[model samples]
Target: MSHPPGLDLGQLRSHLDRERPGLVGGPLSGRLIEGGRSNLTYEISDGTSKWVVRRPPLGHVLATAHDMKREHRVIAGLHPTAVPVPEPLLLCEDEKVLGAPFYVMEFVEGTPYRTAAELAPLGAERTRAAVLGLVDTLVDLHAVDPAEVGLGDFGRPEGFLDRQLRRWGKQLDASRNRELAGIDALQSALGRSLPASPAPTIVHGDYRLDNVLIRQDETDGVDRIQAILDWEMSTLGDPLTDLGLLVMYSARLELPDSPISTTASAAGHPAPAELVERYAARSGRDVSAVSWYTAFAWFKLAVILEGIHYRYTLGQTVGAGFDRIGELVPVFIEHGLTTLKDPKNSQNSQNSQNSSEG
Candidate 1:
């Protein structure tokens, strides 16, 4: 069997037999799912049954951030709920099996549309419907009671917004390369204007249209969001933070030849106002403080992209776009400042954008 990078098929098969015997019917083959800049993911198969494996990136020494166990726990907790999540199968904490901790789940069939080009073939009407579906699904996700789903203790809700600002600040400092203008001002502004958060709920730290998988329904339209993938940052917190990120991504970003971007720049996508109104009407959540959240989203994404760029500078990253990722960080910082400075839709900073109960 051909082996994908960062995985040993023989060791994986042996571990599966010891942990989940009879799970595999034949030899296992695997392929790396590209485009993930954080945790590494793979599609593994036994020729009869297919599964997905998620693990930390190679040389990722921080176990807490890219923890497979945490991701598995969150997914399993939401399995019985209304949330559309891939069923968790097995979690391997032992690093000896795959050179890192990893988890397996049933392979879900759907499209995680990442770029405007990818969504173009679906046409304007379908693209518009698909993006709106993302917001509806988010409302559904935020509606779940953390305590009922056994996720009440997932994170610290009190002072969640404050801690988020400080945490991302430290993350930025860790990856500080060149002098980024307005970044300090944006951070200070966010710290000084922290708004009161709503009641706590499960927050999808990285909610976005591209992060979700969509499929066509019986009407032959993209109305169904099959699964909301990437739960590594799942936690309990103020839910509107999720909305802020959506707003940030919804902005029309014109980065000439920029490699890093979001699908919100696509045509036929709903305006930021429409998305917020939909959430407010359906979820009944107060989105007044959402502007602050969107600003924070810009800062958070800036830090993340900078980290990737930093790694690339050190020759530590592999991929086609890493070379150009650094160029996008300053752009994010600029947007962060702009969003926070806006009085009409100010939301404070937090990487995890949650929509709390209104």
Candidate 2:
């Protein structure tokens, strides 16, 4: 089920003729961008203008999830708002055209940072500002009126948190390789300590630093967030969960027993607490209960990392990143365990209780 090298030039031209009408002309040139885990993306051009094409990965895809129509809808809904998202151009759900559903969007030009080391040249001040910009964007996103933005019906809002915990937990159980004692313990801990959440807000399911694109402006330092990539996981859910996941990936928590690096200087990232504080200040949202979110974040990450570890064990992926995933599993599990130790750290539960009482 390998994807076509790029947008099929002949088919693309034909599709343009019908849908877009004279937008794309002449032979098309395309370059593939690496590092996306789920979708197939390519930077395509006709030598004059550029565009991006997105389609499902080259293999069997779950029918219930990974729908191209949903991705297009999410991006399209965000375009009228302050959120920096790529503009969706065309959506083709007909499978005969590209072997699966596909969509095209304006090519957002900028550099994507995968590690803090890559951003080191910008110095701490500018890099921190850029990171804060992402936080601001998220604040604006959470503040948006989903009904006014035409995304109120995008996903199920009721019981979203419960569904998420159950869904990821099931995924972890189904993909386990060799018994992980910490995983079972963390699951039990999270289950018993589940928190209540406020009304569901739109959550970018996999928000992280790498998913944002940054560009340098000589006069004013780093400029605007050009675009937010990868909305496949966007949905109506607990917005704090998005913040928690960001902390899990971007924060440096103490891993006393693990050999992995625990500092920004060592692991090449900034502290998560600082980011959380920044978000709270800019958004005017209380983050005193963020610890529970952080714990849940680690739990979610551990499940994802363990799933990748299982794939690596089965010869699905070959690379240091995939191999190192197994080592990081225990680190994430430990974070979850530490968070669960205290019963008072239930951020979601408190929020739910407060809402119910109100």
Candidate 3:
């Protein structure tokens, strides 16, 4: 059987046999999982045993993005926690095995709702329960003490917000091709008003509805988040960054046929403010600076989309929907700028002042 690009089934089977003998029960067949624009994820099976694999994109990979080892590390660390993550089976750093570093984990059976239409079938009540579960899982993740989980050295949290702004700024610069109006303004404004981060925790850098796998509980017939996938950006930092990214996605894109994924427009999906309030009440972290973090999430996503667009231009990206990714960058930049300057976020200025002083 023909496997997807960036993965050689024969080599993979050979490696699995060597590392975990008898792990492969039959011939291995695989296909690339769609809807992932950053890393290439594959679902492989040996006729009986199934597994999921993750690797970097085809080409033009950014420097600090798509670290398979780091992804595996965080998942392994969190597997035992209340936060749901796939059980990491093995991590392979030998580049020759797959031409790039990759890892394998147990295949999680669930649906990653990518659009409003996909979520509409669950009915408003079920959808509401599932989305609220996303918030609760996030709180559970942030509640874990990183040191106790052996992830204390996972990231540098002291200057996290500043570093994140600078990191994504550099990422945007790296993907620069066309002139992105207001991107510079957005980046500069984020730098000018960094919020004081609360006590650091393990953050799912790209937390959203689609990034998680939701399975219906047979006992209750209620949809529940089975596993939180896509940990390529997981790190130790401001946990609110995760909430901000979640909130940004919770708002409707409003663009026709936008390539960005969101379930916010779905029936019973929680509002951005409601998600923020739930997180604050559960995590007990001051969310007063959420606007700044939300703006930063917008900036971060714009850079990410631009990077995907850049790779698409170079014929390095895999899968459909990439041709339209370039159109979303400008919209994200505008959102970031507007979120920063929104009068409702005037409290963010005081938060920034307090953070800078602290």
Candidate 4:
């Protein structure tokens, strides 16, 4: 199982042939998808059906962090649940197959909106409905009983929040170059503002607009969420963290600066606040505490993006996105600071208390 300098197309096709046998009709066609920072994703087709293959990045990665087995198990467990996840097909732990561990799944075809502008063509009514649909999906995901879904063992239930904060904090420290005063300040603020945990729910680790897939059948009129992609970070944890991460990542560009613009409706996307209200109404979960979640989301995103920054500095990245991501760290830090300034908002205050006790 020698790791190739990059993806081996010939070997991949041979493996597919051996694995699926008569299912594939012809020789596979490979098209590499851009923008995945931590994994290699390939779109493969046999002239009839399309499938996706995901494997680890070319170099070193955290042990157990990108386990294809865990990802396959999680998606497979959630198949019968309401969460719209891709149908996983095969998982190969034998490193000899593709140089590193990889898994294959049904190729889902749909537009993944990276910004609000892309969501705009849906018009105000459909846009609002679509946002609500996203919330509904999250609610449905959280509502499923882990035991029934066979995901009760996703991760340790106790101390999930504390461990998350500590984990991200460590990640930030390890990836920081030097003299990042704001990074230090953000770490302190996050540590001090820790919220009590909510009843543990399935956390999507990276719940945001871009991670979702939408089916826009005009006849059906955008009725179903096609799939929720990238389950590498899925776990059992504080669900509010997922909500917070969404708000943080999709923060409106007017009052607060977010990496992905919420006003992207010109491009066709819903605003962040609208998305939040939709989620609150659908989930029946208190939305008042959303601010804290937003702040925490910023902290977590900053940490994650900084890891990309570290890689870019090491000359490991091949795309343009990672080149500028390091510059966004301060924007997230500022958002975190703004959130803490008004932490006493009645809605979020109650949530904080509830979470601390949970």
> What does the lDDT read for residue 349 in candidate 3?
30
Please give the lDDT score at residue 290 for candidate 3. 92
Tens digits of lDDT, candidate 3, 92-142: 999899988999999989999989889888877888888899999999999
Clashing pairs in 2: 195-348, 195-349, 196-348, 196-349
| Lowest lDDT 10-residue stretch of candidate 3 | 349-358
What is the full ranking by lDDT, best candidate first? Answer: 3, 1, 2, 4
Residue 258 of model 3 has an lDDT of 78
Which has the higher TM-score value, candidate number 1 or candidate number 2? 1
Better of 2 and 4 by TM-score: 2
Predictions in order: lDDT: 0.84, 0.73, 0.86, 0.71
TM per candidate comes to 0.92, 0.87, 0.89, 0.85
1 or 4, greater by TM-score: 1
Ranked by TM-score from best down, the candidates are: 1, 3, 2, 4
Q: State the lDDT of candidate 4 residue by residue for 1-358, as single tens digits.
A: 3323456667777776788787688766777786564677788777888888888877646748788888888899987777889899888888886778898999887767675557656665665556567777888898878878888878886988678878888888788784554767777777776667767777888776667877777786764578988888889887878877775654443433334344333322344565577777777777676777777777787787788788789996665456677777777777777776764441233333322322
Candidate 2 lDDT trough over 10 residues, lowest sum: 259-268
Question: Which candidate number has the best lDDT?
Answer: 3
> What TM-score does structure 1 among the candidates reach?
0.92
Best by TM-score: 1
| lDDT against true structure, model 1 | 0.84
Residue 225, candidate 2: alpha-carbon lDDT? 77
